[model samples]
Target: MKNIYLLFGICLAAFLLNMALIKLAVDLPEFFTSHLNDLLCMPIVLSICLFIIRSFSRNKGIKISLFSACSLAALYSIYFELYLPDNSTRYTSDVIDVILYFSGAITFWLVQGMEAGRKSSAIKKAA
Candidate 1:
C-alpha cells in the first residue's frame, strides 16, 4: 500500500539521518542518538517484511496482526537485549529499547489499519 511505503520511507529516512548525525558528530540530544533507531527499527523492518509477504502471497489486503507484531517485539527484546548483551560486548541491555520496539510495532499496526480502512471505504464509495 502507498501508506505503508510512505511510512517506511519516512522512518527509514529518519533512521538514516540519525545515523548520519552520529557519524558526523552532530552533538544532538541523547534520545536522538541513542533511542531513535530502536524506536524506528520495527516499523521500517516490519513494513518491508509485510510488503514482501503481500507480494508473494498476492494479497494486498493482508495485514500483520497485533499479536504477531508484539510477539516480534518480544523476540527482538529477548535476543538483542537479554541474549546478545551477555554474548557480545557490542550490544547492551536496555529496558527502554524493549519498550520502544513495541511502540514501533504498534505504530506500524495502526498505520496499516488506517490504510486498510481507507481502501475499504473507497471501495464502498465506488460501489
Candidate 2:
C-alpha cells in the first residue's frame, strides 16, 4: 500500500540519521553526559515516525508501523551499543539506552495515535 512506502522511507531516514548522530556522539568531546549526548536523535526519529504514521495510518492505533519501528529501534540500538566506542570514554551502553530507543518508538506511536484520534473526531464533527 501507499502507507508502506511512506513508512519505509521514514524508517530509512531514521536509520541514516541515527547512524550519523552516533558518529557525532563518538567524536564530540564535550561536557555533556553520554546519556544526554546519545539522546540527540530521539526527537528526530520520533518525529519522522510520528509524522508518517499520522499521515498514512487511518486506523486507531499504530499497527502498521509498530513492528517495523520497534524492531528497527532495537536492532539499531544493539548495533550501536556493540560497535560504538562508548566503553573507551565511559559512555557505556547500558540497558537504559535500549529502553530509550523503545521508549522513542512507543512515544512515536502514542503521539500519532492521538493525532489520528483528533483528525477522526474533527471529520465526524464536520460531517
Candidate 3:
C-alpha cells in the first residue's frame, strides 16, 4: 500500500539528509557545526515525515508514522554518536537534537493533517 511507500520514503530521506548534513559539517567551522545541526535536524526530519504523510493516508496512520520517524531518528542519532568515527560526537548530544526530534515530529503531524484535509476536500468535491 501507499503507506509502505511512505515508510520507505521516510527512511530514505532521513538517510540522505543525514549524509548531506555530515558533509556539511565537514565544511563548516566548529562554531557553526553545533548550531547548524540544531536548526537543520528538525526541518529535514519534519519535511520527510510530512512528505510521506502527504503522499499516503490522512488518518492516525500518519501520526503513528511521524512518531515512528522520530524514534528512528533518535536511534539513528545514538547509533551514529557511538559508532560513527567523527568529531561531532559532542554536537550529537546537544539538547538541541532532542528538541529537534520532538519539533520535527509535531511539525510533521500538523503538516500531514493539513495536507490530508485538503486532499479529503478535493476528493469530496470530485465525488
Candidate 4:
C-alpha cells in the first residue's frame, strides 16, 4: 500500500504538472504539448487501476501482473486512440498518439518491474 501510494502520488504529480503547463501557456515544445504528455497517461491510469484493485482486495498491496497491466493499457490505448478519436470531435485521429500510448505503457511496465526488483533485493538484504 505504501508503494502504491508513492507510485500514484508521483504519477498524479506528473499529470498535474503537465496539465498545469498546458493551462498556463508555458512555452513547451510542440511535441511536448501534442505527444509527450500522452506518453505519461498510461502510468497515470495504470497506477490508479492498481491502487483501486489493491484497495479492495486483501492482498497486501500486490501490484498488477505485467500481463494484466499490459492488457489494460492496450484496452485504454484502443479506447483513446481508436474509439474516442473516431467518435469525438474533440479528439483528432492521430496514429502517433497510439504509438505514444504504447510507449508509455511499456515504460511503466519496465519501471514497475524495476521497483519490484529493488524491493525484493531490499527485503533480502534486511533478512
Can you give the TM-score per candidate against the true fold? 0.95, 0.53, 0.46, 0.78
Local distance difference test, each candidate: 0.93, 0.58, 0.56, 0.75
lDDT of 1 at 23: 99
Which candidate would rank higher by TM-score, 2 or 4?
4
TM-score of 3: 0.46
Q: Give the alpha carbon lDDT tens digit for every residue of 59-117 in model 1.
A: 76889999999999999999999999999999999999999999999999999999989
Give the range of the ten consecutive residues with the poorest summed lDDT in model 1.
Answer: 51-60
Return the number of clashes found in candidate 3.
Answer: 0
Residue 64's lDDT within candidate 4 is: 67
- Collision pairs in model 2: none
The collision pairs in model 3 are none
Off by over 4 Å in 4: 1-7
User: lDDT by residue for model 4 over 1-127, one digit each (tens)?
Assistant: 4544565677678778878999999998888788866777777788777767777899854766778766776787788777997898988767787787777677677777777788889999999
> What's the lDDT for candidate 3?
0.56
> Lowest-scoring 10 consecutive residues by lDDT in candidate 3?
31-40
Model 3 Cα shift for residue 119 (angstroms): 0.2
CA displacement after TM-score superposition, residue 124 of candidate 1 (Å): 1.9
Report residue 85 deviation for candidate 3 (angstroms).
10
Sorted on TM-score, best first, the list reads 1, 4, 2, 3
Q: Which structure is stronger by lDDT: 1 or 4?
A: 1
Q: Candidate 3's residue-wise lDDT over 34-100, tens digit each?
A: 4444434554555555557756766544444566757866765665544453555443445555565
